[model samples]
Target: MAAADPPSPTGMGFFGMLSFRRSATAVASFDPAQEDELLALHALHAHVADRLEALSSHAQPQGPVLSLPFLSKLLDAVLSSSDAFRAVLALAPVAAAVSRPPADRLAADLLDRSIKMLDVLNAASLTLASLRGAHRAALTAASCLLAPALHRAHFARARRAIARIFPDDAKAGATAPSPSSRTMRALSVSVSKNWSAGRHMNAMAAHLAPPPQVPAAAAAGAGCGLGLALYTMSSVLVFAMWALVAAVPCQDRASAAISPPVAPPKQAQWAVPMSSLQDRIAEEWRRREKKGSSSGSAATAGLLAEMQAVERAARDLNSLLEEIAEEEEDEQAAVAIVSEERTREVTEQAEELAAACRALEDGLAPLERQVRAVFHRVVACRAEVVRCMEHVPRTASSNAAASASGVPPPQHHSF
Candidate 1:
């Protein structure tokens, strides 16, 4: 029978299948393009890590109201950096599989670091959401207080003007409009509706027209007094018009009710010539009316233009706030999803690494046993050789001693 062939070295176990030696050779082969790709990946990882660290340091929440603009910018940066790092991480398993042990170790380390960074990003996104909610609450509270405060301020200014225009007795006796008065309601409504309408000077002129049926002396005295009051109340009229325009539901009806056409009294009946005083009053009224119709119209038009401009600005502000809020929400959702996915991916990678380790250990166990068996056989063979040599040793030395002592030598026996 043919001698039995020795076992064929058991295919070198898992080490042979993994071919780590081949990986080492591949690592030694430096294709510039591959080197460049690896370098790029490393650089990208460093950049992303730096950005994450910076964001983690800076994104601490601090106030009752967050600056939406700032938060929006921060979220954008975090998302971009996290996305870049995630892309790099996605290649980690492939790198680990194909590269040498050192590269595999680096890939595993990178995955761990990336997972930590993602956790940081998730925390920041949640903080931003909380801040947004707080900001919205603050805005709502301010909105609740705004209109009423403005109404109160407008009425207070109107009251002061009315006091300065009228006599102390009349002012003391006058009952000011209540906050809930229809006139105030009308004023607010009209301001909202007719603020852009063109000036109606005739209506204003009629409204300011003087009362009829006074004695010449009384008229003169009144004219002089009226002139003084008008001087004091010139500035008051501008604000008063705002109030009147707001208070009067209908301009035609208010004007008709306030001023009725009165025929001038017979000039002959007057003992004193009050023409100068009358002229002064009429001149003042005419000047004031003309100013209201002409220059005041221009001013009103400019004011309306300004108001419209402010409205546009407010609209833009509102839209920007809404955009920031929406972006925060979207970023938060993205962060949550990414974080969960990354966790699962990391778990899978860890399991794979563990499996690979277990496989390596299993493969190493049989190889260790084979090496021990070979070592034991070599030791036994050495012991047998030593025993045979001991039995045959000292023959030459013994023969030399016997010749010196005249002793007989042993003869060889033939089989």
Candidate 2:
């Protein structure tokens, strides 16, 4: 036999082997029609949701899961719906602001939505791994298209998680002093006055500012070109300032100058300036001095008019009171005469209440029957469900074993 030439690395034979290996791998890993893959992803999602529920029921952590850094990674890996993530995270600050318990509705909703998002991610990841052919190509394209959306979703979820972890503080800080008071104090320091006086002057002084001082001649001479320009400019500035000062109304300057020296308005300044009002008050006071002055001519002249009217009213009131007393006595006598009637009314009402209670009790009878009937139906339904579900494990085991033995599964209903 002729000696076989050494296998050439550059030859078609080597290339053909490499291609075959690659094709085999592609075929093994790709599943374009991966129905089971999709199902598995869904199953995993459901499992995760159930897990989240279990976590919620148990004692809540000091912080919400939404705030967790892991959530950011997980969400980034899986989320595609940016709007959905934002909606959920938006509730986080609200949950924190209310200082609610972990079981609060907003927090629970966030947990539920997060669990759902995880489900979506699990489904997507599985779909990415198992997909093949055109389906794989489509999903890959879709994932690229949705990249921004996924990123935004991750950001929104992260924000919500932060809100849940840090609740708002109702008592944030001490109350600040009023703005007016602060303004007064600032003015007092500026013009060498007390706080009370400063308040009145500050508002008017806003317009009475003094001109800036001129720089010294030596300083001007020693200046660089810019400084010389500034120094030379000083005279022009003084003229401008004087012009501005002259433009201010005389009344404004007078008010501004005097305001700081003024004190707060006194109570008498608030009262109406009328001599008659003072004299009338004094005359009314003098009438109450003597023992007989309480009913004297001076007292009865003007101020005692109302008191005289009150005396007449007292006489009327006493007459009315006597009439009312007689009427009340008559009413009491009548009430005694009708005591039997009231008792009869009460007895009738009691009997009616007893009848109503008996009727209510009777009404519950049918409800009791319904409850029992429902209970039995539920039991039957549960048994049927258990029986149906029980077959699943055995069927799965059998299918697995048959697959291993090169046997086919039994044909069942097809969708």
Candidate 3:
């Protein structure tokens, strides 16, 4: 061969050959499809790290840990990850089709669980309503005429009304605080009064459970990669939902048990960040739970910054009221002068609470919309999977489920 290729620099050289062997080994171990799927999974993991983990730093740098912008982007990441995961599943090997019995059951369970999140969404919306009520109470109190400008009697009455609305639920059967307006009255029913955040989230956790582990023998067969991918994606979904519930306010809120489901096979690239996210959230939750417990409140605090803002504003305003509302009148004049300093303090807190309310509500509107979108997306994905995996006719209950979830039956299965 003319002694020509004396250790050519390309593939024939020592280093080149070593690289080639490594490449060949990788190729032999994973077909291009599996390799691509793995890259996609890595991307998903990195996204969680990049988007979700980044929030921890921003929690202090920007403002509140769960600021409005943070929440908006958090939901965006959730939706984006869902879509990306579904894309991966859509492109899985055709051989994966026959072996999807495990995934089939998984998809069905996920679909059912997604519906249960509606109740969570409803509960969150109710919490938002309660926030609005608190905001209204702040406004009513702020408008009260203090010492000089208006009658002390008027200020006293306002204080009493708002106080009625502000009692912690630890006091049983507390009525909604009467507001100055009918709308205000309606807003005062704190979800914390009757709703149990712990119970609702526990129900959500029920749906977040991991699918049964596939037997090793079966997993070694044709669709092993797809099965792993499904389980991995399911773990991501479970953690995301549990995290969302943690961020919202709820009563008797116990952290959802997610260790089993959130933990993927060891050494997984995604597992690190997933576990990190879980740990941070759980830590924050424990902190909040401890704080609420120490404070003797019936409902536990939430992870949201705005939630804290709401509480602070309410507490400060109420403190001011205790000093002014319970005051023994001088009885020298009909007009009680509200010192400008006192008025300023009350106004500041009112505006602060109002601003916080707007931000929280603004954040919540998109969050709820995204939750609904998630619900429908899961429904559609499940429908597609059912069509692809099972040739059997659709049963009445399945059709009803599809109907109830608001995603029409798939007209045709193209994937």
Candidate 4:
């Protein structure tokens, strides 16, 4: 034996000690540029964490009511956090390139957390816009109350002007002239020299007319009989045509009456409960961290999975809102042309969209809660990591000093 080498500092075996030494050497040998980059990344993480905490504080409410002031503050916080988050995302690839495995995993987790926070912020923004729109609509409706009176005044003015143009006869005492009298008066005023000339020509022609070949009485009797026969034939034809029309069914009406009814669309369902998934992810992280495994990687994966689920729910909600918007546009365009029959259809569609919005909101509530809880947890974890990182260098320096002074290194708990 080569003078039984002094027991390794790690105390596991030669191999374990060698591994520890190698790791320490690698950390010590990190390029100055890489170290600077890592520090910058970590600082960015701290900034983002602070922003998140501020946002959460502003968003947190003890009661159901969300005041306008609170919402405004929350919006501001979210906007600031979003700006910091974007900066972090932009530097993520660079951070990944220079960071160790644990740090890399942490960066990824922070990215996921930031994305989820953004999703929550977006949903809140949409809700705020909707509330503002409804408020404006209520104000507009209130303003419309004055319209009817204005319209009445306008109509009265128009009626007065018309009465002046075509005044009613006071001497008539509400008894208007008959249609025959009016027509006769108009005809008398329209008569001219042409009418008198035509009447004189007709009298001259009748006086000089040739006599009929047959007796007048026989001719009259024959004419009457012919006219009676023609009348009877016309009456029979009219009755037959009416009966034919009544007996035949219309093809279009029959087809419409027998058309099949359309089936309603299926309602959407969420497969995973967001709250339960969040709990599972947090528990798994805790268990993995205790076991000394790569808990960061595991935790990041869980967060990603949860984030995807949340994104899906948010996407569905956005799609539903888009559909509602389209329906509203259609309703508005049709307002001028809408008939009594179509009004009911439009109303029914409005009700359906309202119901859909309510359902979407109900579904999003749980997801929002889950996101908030995860955000809080992630922020706490980040704080701990930052604290540990700050302590590590100080502890390492103290240990080196102790070793140089022939004193034992101070024992410390592993992170």
Query: How much does each candidate deviate from the true structure in C-alpha RMSD?
Result: 47.0, 41.0, 9.8, 42.3
Cα error, candidate 2, residue 55 (Å): 38
lDDT of 2 by residue, 176-195 (tens): 22223332221012222222
Q: Global lDDT of each model? A: 0.30, 0.27, 0.53, 0.30
lDDT, residue 381, candidate 4 = 40
List the candidate 1 regions with Cα displacement exceeding 4 Å: 1-33, 42-94, 97-100, 103-126, 148-415
Query: Which pairs clash inside model 1?
Result: 187-246
RMSD of 1: 47.0
- For model 4, residues 317-358, the per-residue Cα lDDT tens digits are 334334544665786743333334433433343344344334
**Which scores higher on lDDT, 2 or 4?**
4
Candidate 4 lowest-lDDT run of ten: 262-271
TM-score of 4: 0.25
Error of 4 at 84 (Å): 25
Off by over 4 Å in 4: 1-340, 364-371, 404-407, 410-415
Ordered list by TM-score, greatest first: 3, 4, 1, 2
Model 3, residue 220: displacement in angstroms?
Answer: 5.7
- Per-residue lDDT value at 306 in model 3: 66
